[model samples]
Target: MIVIPTRLKSTRFENKILCDIFGVPMFIATANVAKKVDDVLIAVDDEKVLKIANDYGFKAVMTKTTHESGTDRINEAVSKMGLKDSEVIINLQADEPFFEGLNLTKFKEFAMEQILNQDAFMASAYKYIEKSEADNPNLVKVVVDENSTALYFSRSKIPFDREPYNDYKGHIGIYAYSVKTLMEFCDFSQSKLEKTEKLEQLRALSNGKKISMLKMESKSIGIDTKEDLEKALKVFKKVNND
Candidate 1:
């Protein structure tokens, strides 16, 4: 199952999800793409969003407006749904209308394998980013161990290079977990690193949970501002033409 946590307002782009993407609303477009791979449910914060989801014929549930993160919102939705503990779930961001170069089918398979193996409580993808682009604080960076297990995630540039190199792995916001792990993760209190970095995944790491990372060729463009929306529109047009 793929769950999208839809918050109506945004600090950078107010009600951005309602913004148009090639004639479709951003959140609805995200749902449309995700439904191609698996079941989709929008965990919405506002009733206005819920009505839109219902009108679009997508499954949706109302969540609290007080949740701090998308992950927390989806966890609440899943808990209310009564899915089995082992159900594989991908926390797909509503902001990501499309993920160029990623095969959602393969990603789902990887999530299933990792969750069933129980080696890691969570799974996520990272893509190689240029050294020049790595300095942008909006783009989160991740460092992984030899085994592809996440070592750390941060907004600032990592591994200060003595000699400049370009192997920076930009962290994709999407995350995968089994129902049990999702529940366990949300139960944890926000960690010091999480609050400091404003990243939710740090809570998992600080609590000794392992996150298996997969390297993929994806340029995930999550729309955070009006500029991002314009960028995404151009990218979407180029992708379709290609």
Candidate 2:
């Protein structure tokens, strides 16, 4: 199952999830994209979000507005649904309106491959970033070990670029996890690194959760500011017009 953790409040953009994209709300647009993957649900904290989900005929679960992170909300939402400990779940961030549903469909295959290995219950993805994206603080970067395991995630550029090297990968904010690990994630306090980098994936790495990351081609833009929304609007128009 794929669950989208949604909230009405956004520090960067006011009511971002509820913001209109073309015609639909950003979160509602994202839900339509994700619904093509498999069983999808919106894990919402606000009554307005729940109502929007219902209006769109999408399944939703009410979670606490107090959840510090989407992962926490996900744990609560799934727990309410009585999912099995071993159930696989994919988390699709609600602000990602431009994300391709096809990428998520393919993600399930890649994530399933990693989960079968037993060495990892969490899996994510990233793609090589252009130099222009390196300076963008909103684009989270990642460094992976030789085994494709996540070493670190940061809003700042990673690896320090000590030499003639390049090849930075920006993390796509999607994650797949086993229900057991999902529940365990809620019990963890925010790690020092997580607080410093402002990247929640650090909490998992700091706690020794092996996260396997698959490298894929980059696509879509995460809406952090109005500029990103405008770019997405143009992209949406071109795609639809084509």
Candidate 3:
């Protein structure tokens, strides 16, 4: 099951989820993409969001607004859904209106492969960062181990190129987890590095969870502000034309 965690309050943009890009609310766009998967639900914290989900004829559940992060809200939703411990759960971000269906299908395929190997506790997507994005702190960078496991995630550029570094990968917000692992993550408290870096995935890494990252060729524009929304609108129109 894929769970989209959405909140009405956004520090960067007021009522970001409610903001329309191409005549539909941002979260609705996200939900529309996610509904293509086998099972999808919007885990919302506000009545307004729930109403919006129902209006769109999508499955949704109201959760407590006190969740500290999207992962927390997803965990609560999973419990309410009575998912089995072995069920797979994908965490899709509500702001990602531009996520393509092919990319999502690839993500699910990668996750199923990892589950068959019985080594990955969680999985997420990453793509090679363009040189232009290296300086943008909003584009989080990651350092990976030889096995393609994440070593660290930071808002700052990693592996400081003392020697003209030309390559790095940017972390995407999507995540997939086994139901058992998701419950375990909820039981554990946030780690120190997670708090300092303000990156929630660090908590899983610090706790010794192995997260496999699938390299994707496609990239989606995340809507965080009015400027980003405009850019996404343009992309949406272009895709619609195509």
lDDT top scorer: 1
Q: Give the runs in model 3 whose Cα sits over 4 Å from its true position.
A: none
Cα distance off (Å), candidate 1, residue 237: 1.4
Q: Tens digits of per-residue lDDT for model 3 on 128-231? A: 98767877777788888888898889988887888987778998888988888888888889999888877789989999988999888875988767888887
Task: Give a tens-digit lDDT track for model 1, residues 1-242.
Answer: 99999998876688999999888889999899898889999999999899999999999999999998889999999989999999999988889987642467777888899998997899998889999878888889999999999989998998678897779999988899999999899999999999998889999999989999988887658888898888878987898899
Off by over 4 Å in 2: none
- The alpha-carbon lDDT assigned to residue 189 of candidate 1 equals 94
Q: What's every prediction's RMSD, in angstroms?
A: 1.3, 1.2, 1.3
* Candidate 1, superposed: residue stretches over 4 Å from native: 100-102
Q: How close to the true structure is residue 36 of candidate 3, measured as C-alpha lDDT?
A: 89
List lDDT for all candidates, in order: 0.89, 0.86, 0.86
Q: Deviation in angstroms for 116 in model 3?
A: 5.0
57 Cα displacement, candidate 1 (Å): 0.7
Task: Tell me the deviation in Å of residue 183 in model 1.
Answer: 0.8
TM-score of decoy 3: 0.95
